[model samples]
Target: MNGEGKVVCVTGASGYIASWIVKLLLLRGYTVNATVRDPNDKKKTDHLLALEGAKERLKLFKANLLEEGSFEHAIDGCDAVFHTASPVTLTVVADPQAELIDPAVKGTINILKTCTKVSFVKRVIVTSSISTVMFPRSPLGPTDLVDETTFSDPSLCEEKKLWYVLSKTLAEDAAWRFANANEIDLIVMNPGLVIGPILQPTLNFSVDVIVNFINGKNFFNRRYHRFVDVRDVALAHIKALETPSANGRYIIEGPIVTTNDVEKVLREFFPDLCNDDKREDIDMITKTYKLSVEKVKSLGIEFTPTETSLRDTVLSLKEKCLI
Candidate 1:
């Protein structure tokens, strides 16, 4: 469907990746109904309002992932819904199902259900993670390149230990099941570690990782990076929505680099932040893993190079005074 004049609802509109998606959608002349947990949070909404054409076309709605029908109002009369609201945290929670899995799965079901109720809704694009398709399973062959077809085996998820991975896997599976049973046009975009500069420095999660690294918080001094820029991932979502021929899953993979590679880039770009005298206590693991992007490429999208992505991320951090 053409997004020229269509109204689209983007959940987690204040987030790192979702905010970019909202900005791009507004720039493309699409009306955006951006959902946030709290509409009163001026700090977040103000940045979105400041985006080009956002004030004219963007609408903010308060919604919760666990609350039933919370998204219905935001999605009402909308042509498409971009479900990017899901819990992403490093700390393991007590109840993975409640904190992570339930929200991811239930929120998807809620959004799709709302779409089914609205006849004008033709597409539902979900923001899934590469973790759903990539790690957790031992590589079958020497080539670790995973694709849309690759799914993380739940058997590999030890109870609630690797709860984040399990949550994504279960949530995505639930989405597919609901889509197939309801016969809805469902497309999922699985992005790797998302890193980039943010429209608002306060809303930058990807930048936090870079900042932590610069501050020597990465305990092992280890480098094992697999990431994609938030901008590219946002563009992929827009493409998935506009490209009617696009269906099923797409793996959005960026160039694979290690922590050392990130450090090297920092040293070149922000020498002030790089301490050569500091001992490298971190371990660097350069394991080969490829995420097949042929499907997304077929939809006429190209990803930025790993070096460029890293530089952009570093530059963004520097701009925000994070590094």
Candidate 2:
């Protein structure tokens, strides 16, 4: 087994993407130290404990991203760390620093600080979002592809009150600064809007978007949506750890699509669930952008078909009785 006798820590283990990573890690025979806010909460963690290798290899630890040493116990002695714990909010709040920035920047720094303290910790993988790399900017040329080289302007995010984007950008920036200064092997995975199956019961931001569409509660405006399977994002984390040559950031994404594109997929595959009434006023636009996957594809990561991902997501929602 690739993960035989290896151990790793996955922060925010109960999240939409992290849960999948933990499961994949366990199946590969790695001892997993998973961090969540409340390890004792069954609603948040029961699904994790029910996984194939949970009994023998998985251990849940309560940790908070805001606290400085919260992650020390969880990350200590692990071979690598996946820092997926961070605040995510799209709406405006009274305090951006308290609610968004502190947990992200300080939390990321805390994880790296622990990694530096532990002699056995070799690599650190941070689950950053595509929002960090791309943002609402002036249109690029048709041939221009947004790649790893481009980063969302923090000032712009702050000015426009894109709290989520600001948090991610600052956190990833902090991670890089810490990693480089301390000479830690850091691989950052920037995934597009991740959707697929959910291991945890609660709905995540992205999954909620799918559910809203299914329920036909239309609040979405015309925007280019980039997507990637949660499963692929999970495997990519493991692959980044296993692949010795893997370094820097990798953008795991698919073709840029629109809400209309996704709606068409849903209405075609899930005819019964499509609510046409709410979508009547949706602005159908052809706006789209290009995201280069050359870096991630270099790691031999092939994306799941967008339609398959959407269909599987809806199926998972049905299986879980979320919709």
Candidate 3:
């Protein structure tokens, strides 16, 4: 289960979290097979190649999640697979099951099925969201802190929303079921709103949040779930892969802050871009949801502080000319 000499394949390697995972794996001296939709997309893989030690240890493979057995070649001879590829769209799609549910569930099943074919594949680390575990129950209690055991109720999934949460829940459920049935080692990392700097600013979804905030698009002052740094989430993935004792679900939660907190940070850091006075009309909806990291911490993982995360994210946006 050690990653020093082992080869690990990461799905959606060019993605926000997966890209960081790929970099960390390379830095740890693990050979990384990064799967992208197109290997010819220089814009995607170029940033990954630019990382230290990536030139020699990193390999890019063309793969699609919907295509059955496409991941077989990428996962061949690999000791572990990090399945972080899943559709995450804020707007409600016409067919939630088609766009989110089926892809997430089927893609996870496909990857694990491929893992069953490879004897060397001992561990399968899945990137699940806290949305899968939190936000399902109706009346939020004051002390409701979501933990690893909590799951989003399927009955609560509605039309205008619930698609994303439903997708993650079903996808994770399928992974656990397939792993147990096939006897594959399954480890899931459930991360809250992933923030922090982007390795490739242009290709990351987290960066889009920063861009939207800077552009004053997030005028809604609703309080949401806590945020976790993408770097920390990446580290958690590496730890989950290396730590053989790590199993089940681990909740990666950071400081629980509201949209006002984000605006305050932006106003303090980049006052020129953010109008402090314009936030008066912002409506803040506080939802009682806190993810317990005690389980993940038991695995010897330490998360970065919230201030550090926000500062790093702001600095990264400025560097990318997004603010």
The lDDT per prediction is 0.80, 0.86, 0.81
Q: How do all models score by TM-score?
A: 0.90, 0.93, 0.91
Which digits, one per residue and each the tens of the lDDT, describe model 3 over residues 1-323?
24578899999999889988988888888999999999899878888989888888888999888999999889999999999999997675899988998889999999999999888898999999887786555644667766787887766765437788889988998898888988999999998778888877473555566567777766234444366899889999999887878999998888667666777777777686652334443222235444478998887778887767878888987887766
Instruction: Name the regions of candidate 1 deviating beyond 4 angstroms.
Output: 136-141, 219-221, 272-286
C-alpha displacement of 262 in model 1, angstroms?
1.3
- Cα RMSD for candidates in order: 2.8, 2.4, 2.6
Report lDDT (Cα) of residue 51, candidate 1. Answer: 92
Lowest summed lDDT across 10 adjacent residues in model 1 is found at 277-286
Q: Which candidate's lDDT is highest?
A: 2
Best by TM-score: 2
- Candidate 2 lDDT over 1-323, as tens digits, reads 79989989999999999999999999999999999999889998999999999999999999998788988899888999998998777876899999999989999998999888889998999999988887646535556678888888888888888898999999999899888999999999999778999988878888887887777754455445667999999999999999999999999887767667788888865677654443343432223446689988888788899889999998898889887
When 1 and 2 are scored with lDDT, the better candidate is: 2
Clashes of each: 5, 0, 0
Cα lDDT, model 2, residue 249: 94
Give me the displacement of residue 263 in model 3, in angstroms. 2.7
| Cα lDDT tens digits for candidate 1, 12-73 | 99888998999899888999999999888897788898899887889999999888888888
